[model samples]
Target: MSAQDRLVGAATLKRLRLARGWSLADLARAVSTKAKELGQPLDASVASVQRSVARWESSKGPILPGDRYQLLLAHVYARSAHGQLALSVGSDFSELLYALGHLGESERRLNDLRTLLVRTATDGGSGLLALLGPSTQRVLADALADPSKLDEELLEAMGIAIRDVNRQVGSLPFVRVQLMLTPIVESCRRLLDGTVPDAVLLHLRAVAAQAYTLAGRAAFETRDDEASRALYAAAAGGVGPPWRRAVVHMSHALVTLYSTPGIEAAQQLVDAAVRDARAGESVMVRARAHALQAEIAARAGSARHAKAALALAWYDIDSDCDGDPSPASFSAAHLRGFEGLTELYVGDPSKAHDYFAQSAEALHTPRERVQHAIVSTDQALARIRLNDPEAATELLHGCVDAASATGGRVAAIRLRRARAYLRPWRREDWFADFDDHLIESFGA
Candidate 1:
């Protein structure tokens, strides 16, 4: 069947009406009244309008409303769903129809969908380059048909898109970043299906590897460690530079560290990442790899080893000239956070608090919400260790606020850690408040 013959629009309209507990006749009357108020009076009587509404919401005769009727219908539900969909979708009737069908009765989903559409429109489909508009679709179609058309410029553009999405992983909402990265990763997979010419094969693989690595990060942000591991493995299989391989190895190690009980396996992966970094002469990668190594050592309660790794990490970071790329990039603040964790693990609450404070101060405002939340929770844990449950609870509330908006799994994990540390004071009023807020924001 043709696209126009689909019952998607009809089903959307019916669901929207039913969700409000409104009948066809009620919707018709509402639309008629709204149209007159909006200075576009419907000439049809209420009975006629009701019949039209029924037909509009019918599958047998799936006909879209005219522009005037659409406007009238939107205005009728202006305070609710349809009107908001119209405003967000603008004059693109097809998009409006598709969004209506896609979102169903979830206002939250509608808002998310609106943000995605607006970002796609304003950002020139930067993250969604694979699903670009007609012109780009045409170009991609030609490239897919004949591999030579996947030129260097296009490959570079794809690389930039991958980097852009990678940068959004920590800053943007997890769901939004996941949504943006999925398509790029899928597109890269298709490109790497053995069709590209030998001239650009390695370059294409490099870009594809970057895409997979970033997607792995997105999955990790959502706490989907299994998927994250698979994506990182796919990235490692692709032919890329030594630095890129280091990034993939480090990413895989991170997921393994958190998700599995295989500490030795995680250590081996991070060790490989460190070697790759040294081979590539990337001090930045070395810094990040060592930071991960320090964390692993700290988690294993090897205070001496952890401190040694942190010292090496600090030295590498100081000597680093060029910064790392988005997917596996490390900043001074990140190193400090790792230092804070190491100090806490080593039974130095005061030192951990000092490191976390420095990290918090160094973080970029508004853009580092997730990182800030994680740091706050870690600092709170330090406060708990210092016999200050009230201060820890206060910090946890702030973490809850941050996670409520961004749905950051990293922040949630830190919050869980803080909660565990506060278990001794769980019966206290402040602890109750913190625990209740955590459950409400994240879950039990």
Candidate 2:
């Protein structure tokens, strides 16, 4: 209404758009295109643009919530520049720039930003997002002027934000995020030009491993199993301790088996993971390796081996970590869910249900929650085994929908397989739905 109000709104919009590294023209084009796609005619006048685009970006105006569709578009735009920069500079610097680009004015500070840069640049790669860059120092400093505010809580908050953005949208549309790693790897190469410290190199290697792991997970979700296996293998060879290496190798083995190729090779890799776990120090990592081995053993029809792997995982779970029920090193809640999955696969429904419930309750992260949903699906299968097809179908449907919500294709496929198995006993109408879901889930 007032000029002052309009100016404030415009300034806020300008600030947010800049933070996202988008220009006014870019924002206007996006708005117009989105409106057209929605079958709404854009007025396309200066006044209309000011009222809509400005208000959308403005803090004073209503902060429009992004649905999955809009968020997917935003991620596309964000990662385009991010990927290019990563290739040019390296991940360490690119990641910092990303943090800076996203930070609100209140979140920025100088010295704190410097400290973060120094810590990440020095430490052997800690947080998931820390792989971005040293410029995070400036970004974090600007975001939190008071040094005290940049604690573990803040780091977790940042990790959660990144995960939310990456996971909420389906994986198909957001595949570009994986490409961003190329620039990151390139940047690391430039940063290590010559005579780099051993610690820094180690940290860089650790960061690269994480980059590969992230890319591998993305590939796995997209059913590019070979790509996933290759990325996980690279990650396994990167850095950190033997336990971390073993975990990565175990992940590689899982992806390879999922690809349905060479069962003997997959089994050999699993066996190696088991041997590594036995020799490793980290209880959490050992537990994960064993859990994965258990899943592989089950799939390979080695019921005895599966049970033994499950027992090893449970033992490690009970012994490791400080918290009650103990958190997995990966995430406190994820470990619990994996344990539940192991239980279900080993034919212990009651125990599986208890662990699944715990994981479901404790999960806050999107990925971890998807894992919980898979456990729930396994519970549904257990119900089906007991002849309650109706109850089992309901649970399966719920889990499948939840997995789809998070873009978890692997979990969706498993649910579809279960549904297909139930098709014979169900009514004819259900057959069509089951068939459609199976095709969609498997892309067959």
Candidate 3:
């Protein structure tokens, strides 16, 4: 059978199977028995069913007895089940088969389907509740409640889940499911016996490292530079060669860039991070290191170096990762925001606005989404540069409003500064309100 024919058949079989409420085993059993009676026997195990189902759903396959049996089973099963069992068992079976049908075509779509199934099962049903005994549920819940106690496997799973959930929701709000899952994961780690293998320890360290990196980002946003630095440093301390160490150093570079201790010191740190990241294994880590280098260069008044670094960062963002690119690359609205700011600094507000708009669209988290407000403030600054104080006032007001809504005090302060810079073109009274607000929110 041609590939196209197999895909067509597979898709049809998948729809029919899902429309029915039967498991692979159930369908295999019925189909196998029917085939036997018809003088053609086929295996009915999960693997056999999987294969037969694959053939039937294949768009390019020659439709055989096995395919016919699969279609028949789907027809019979859909009309047979009812109630919670019907919904639970039927949906699970159908979803699984449907998912399998798409496996060869789009792995990402299959992954999405699987995630949906797991999340649905997690959130639904007394049947699911019974499947996971109360004791097991309690254990998992307790384990995830404390990060310091989580084992390696659980930590890695949690890390993946956190990223997945963040992608789905577009924001890592403090009260989100990821936050709820963190403690349970930590608890599991803490409860781990010394029997864990070295391989497991490596994986655990990676998960912990990622968690610390995220935590540091949160801290940095809140103006807790000390805490942010500590978390980033902790992430760096995790075990692994170039990848892990490079990430840690990059985190340090980020903190240093923001702290602005000195251009020379910051550039040195950035250079080291870039070197380590280049030697690292993960493309994601390398990309981040490059991004940080770009930021540092941008801050150092070397527009040429900044542009080069940013270009490298963009390349990393575009590169595919081991068949599965990092979501950070795809979901990086903040990069555009940064790019917009970079363009603005380099005297190209038009390009800056375009990048800023793109970044705003890509931003996923509330904390970072407020970065759009910062962009607006920067736009206002640009307008001021152009001697368009009236337009700048309007933009700054929007910036303030956006920042206030998202709890972006830092952005708000910047907006206020922009307003202050434009005060000479405004009534004297306009200065007091923004001035007082900045002082109150950001202090001296």
Candidate 4:
């Protein structure tokens, strides 16, 4: 068959629709309806759609609407099962979306999809892990003036979409997720003015809080301290589920991770998150809060507080390893890397060495690459503290490449520390090479 005539593997499409309990006919109806709605010029009469779906499933011909309906396909197949499947539109999906009145939401969805697909492939792992169901806890409808009539299905779908966005974090750019949140927040505002049930209003608040949290992180990653702090507070305000509120505090605490003089404030924020996590009985979240506590304590030059926080972190993490992995990245490897970080900054270099060595080997997941890159820089830092310039140079090269590639904030902060160490070795030829590469990668 010609390239356009060939099927895209019916099993992939079938499995996608089937996993969501959609029948072949149901799939055709959805595709056609969406295409028609978007004025995509579809002959979506029941009979035509039937023939198309049949040919697609039988591998006799390419599916109709599937060829040029890249966005539609994304809506159905963005989740994992077959793979991180999506077709390039040969043009920016954003422009077409703007024309079709889906600009922000499309940017959000496609960017999240890109984060899940492109970033993971860049990192390493099974590539584009499964898309979990949306939270069903919230929904928003922009331009829907009578959103009071909004049904539960759409609300559930938004909840799921929020959940999907959750998966893309740490694996993708924060700005990508950040763009789509404003519309949803606006929608939530409109819905709040409507006749939503008491329960649904609560769910909307929770999702709004989450939207705020994601936006806050994006701001934090870009080093916009003021915006990050403001967004985090917005996330905590108003009523929401306890678990989600707990995360807000944790995310807010992380805002201080790179601040040399903000350790005291960071500790207070983390302590607040820890208290909320404890109240919500969110043990894993508590573990993360403690880990941040340890880091902040280390930064403040309080070895006792750091050590105590580290111990509690281990206890909480061990207490809940059997549960589902977090929607965000917090692998055991990262914990070790965090430990190595604490050691390098607050304890002995020799001790930091062993933790980073193990952490590096375990840093193979798609979500862990940013942390992987951050750890590499810190490992270089540890080597420098141990007076191993050559060893440090080798590691710093990889660190620079990884950070530059990901626009990693953590890597940027670590690079400042690495520069200080390298300056002392400026007379060495190896230092010259490292300095030249650093300039090339990050621009002096």
Candidate 5:
């Protein structure tokens, strides 16, 4: 450890305070106010808080404040950091602050949506459909005219279109699939809104569920967590068939795992997926559910649970089974990707590298660009762990273009992680060039 490391806690506290041009008293008021807003309501008044701040800034003070105070401090600093919160506190603290902030923002948005729904209920929902886009409005108008014609043939046609859109999501650019999905979902909304024959209500509900599932996937890939959750909720409520419900549950589990600090919630979702997959008797969907469970376990740092889940996943995939009709695809390549990611989290890097290589090899010809970027990043991280920094750098360099072109938030996040792993080599000429290339591609 360096001398700076020894003094960082005390010095950083003082630096952050002075950087904001906050007097001790001013900071005390802010902290107290934020605490009350968060429902913690600290008992310390301004005079006591001012004294406490002085002690914390002194070299003789405790290394950090108590937990409640730390939370308030993080909230106070995070409000003004503008994405630089990690620099003020540390990564762990910054993560807590970001999670809290996202929760608050999402809660507010949810309340607004609830209010809209209440008003729509009171006002007969006349203007709610009008809030759709021009293209959506046009499509809705056309669809609403034939609300009684939702026959088997028409439903099959819609199913084909939905499957086509689903196939395009990981294969085509995210923005393209997203553009195609909005109108389809809005059309579904119109179908559900217009007067329809009761005989086909269940089928129409299933169709709407599929559209919402696709929209949820699009929103998730683009990092819109709130929209993803809402869409997943809609999909879960209306989806028919256990296998389809399993798919929706697993998709919801993934976004929950990534976006919130709710590991238990994610676990519950994955468990529900597993149950539905079993009830549906789909070996492939069951295998995917187990794989998702492994991912959740890995995220929770439980190597034993992750390994057990992966074992079940492998067993299910290897078993022979009748053909399934669900549109959600899960193959050996995806399983290998799951294994690589799990190992990267909880096991040895050499094993992760082997799994990633298998995943890459198993991908179809003209491999999915977004998947390529994500797997390439996993491979690069494994290389870094194996002490092959140059090879890691090369792997990351090859994927930046695809990631930038596809504009997948998952790809961007993985690339950022890879870049962080290379920070120790930042003084090297190659590192400098790669850093510049990454920044240029992803725009910070």
Candidate 6:
């Protein structure tokens, strides 16, 4: 470590605040917001914020408030100075460094993706996208200063790879896709800073958005809620068409739902999705969207609306599910699982139990697939409500391996909830055994 390393924590905070032209008060407010999200409401009074900001920036106060705080801080600074940020807070957040480090990995990914494309890209990476039509070279941009022109084909190839990659994310390793695409997204953003053809520029923007979206999906599946939200927001900026924009909004809503329990915020996202979908006119998008809408409506104390939206979702499921669904389309099993979830949220665990059981029966005839882990956990939740605690325990034990493999954090959340439900019976032998299993599947 160098001399500057000693001062990293305070200096880093000061620098970031300055870069954003934020005062001590402004920094305090942002910190307060982060704190609120973590369920620690800050005073936010000018006096409280100013003093806290001073102490934090000077290292005179707690540099890291808590593990969750540090993780949230890492997320807030995820896009800029991520290396320095990581080094500064390294001691405070060793377990969470992987989340922050991925930010830097995006920059390095550009070269790696280029090499990969040159060697073995199937279609999207085939020549990295070489498409030419009706006099596009002549329809140039006034934005171009004619510097060393970059390869449009290569950039287009990167974009195609991003869109194509989303199809496989459901089956492939989420971590691998996140690592591969984020860097390409960053490279696309860097390229956009330079002059390129208007057509190429627009194409680059769209691809970057999609890359961010795909990367966000990976982050979400991995249970990195805050990072997923930020990535989705970045993706939302470059959305061009109505259908894509609708998907972006819907995706943003999905992340928001996962991150917070605030019904108002969830409603806002649903409304945004609805507004964007009007132009797209796809029953498929609307269908998938209603599944979310059902969840939000259930959470909002409107069982009638939840049921209505879920019915619409069922109607739309087959509209575009005939072998060639869009990247965001829901399968019959997914819709059924949501139907079960809506029942769970709408105060009917018996119906929820039946829905989840039916869905699981259809989806899990072979073996407990990784993708079904969350659904299985949902089934377990319904069992908890059904007073079949032993059955709930058995289901969780069966699904733990697959659930942890797919999304450990979500699995942990479900397990944690199960543990809480079983708390009153902790004295029982079987309950004690189930408690140990929860500890094993998740952690204490």
RMSD of each: 12.9, 11.1, 11.5, 10.5, 22.4, 19.2
Q: Best candidate per TM-score, number?
A: 1
All models: lDDT? 0.72, 0.54, 0.55, 0.63, 0.71, 0.61
How many Å off is the CA of 6 in candidate 1? 52
lDDT of 3 by residue, 1-444 (tens): 445644654565556555655555666666666556657665456577656655545555534433355334432332234423221222433443343354333444443443343344334433222222343445447554543444554444455544543343213232233333344335324534334445566776666666666556556656667877776776777746776677567656655655655767667767777887788666776766776666666666668877887788778777777753234433356567667666777647777767766765655344355556776677677667666667666666656656654445457567757866866855545455555555564463
User: What TM-score does candidate 2 reach?
Assistant: 0.57
Ranking by TM-score: 1, 4, 5, 6, 2, 3
Backbone clash tally (model 5): 0
lDDT of 6 by residue, 53-152 (tens): 5665664432433334344454444323332222111222222233223222232332232232222322233221211111222222212234136456
Better of 1 and 5 by lDDT: 1
Model 1 per-residue lDDT tens digits across residues 41-150: 87899999999888777777666666577656544543334332222212232344463443232443333433444344334433354224334445666787676678
Worst 10 residues of 6 by lDDT: 127-136
- Candidate 5 TM-score to native: 0.66
Candidate 3 residue spans exceeding 4 A from truth: 1-137, 140-153, 164-195, 239-252, 259-269, 281-288, 314-327, 330-336, 346-368, 426-444
Q: Best candidate per lDDT, number?
A: 1
Whole-model lDDT, model 1: 0.72
Quality of model 2 by C-alpha lDDT: 0.54
Off by over 4 Å in 1: 1-134, 320-328, 365-367
TM-score of each: 0.69, 0.57, 0.57, 0.68, 0.66, 0.61
lDDT order of candidates, top first: 1, 5, 4, 6, 3, 2
Candidate 2: tens digits of C-alpha lDDT, residues 30-146: 656656664764566534554555444555543332232233233223233444211112333333333333322122232233323323322332222333333443444443333
Off by over 4 Å in 6: 1-152, 163-173, 220-226, 318-328, 362-371
Clashes of each: 0, 21, 40, 4, 0, 1
lDDT of 5 at 316: 85
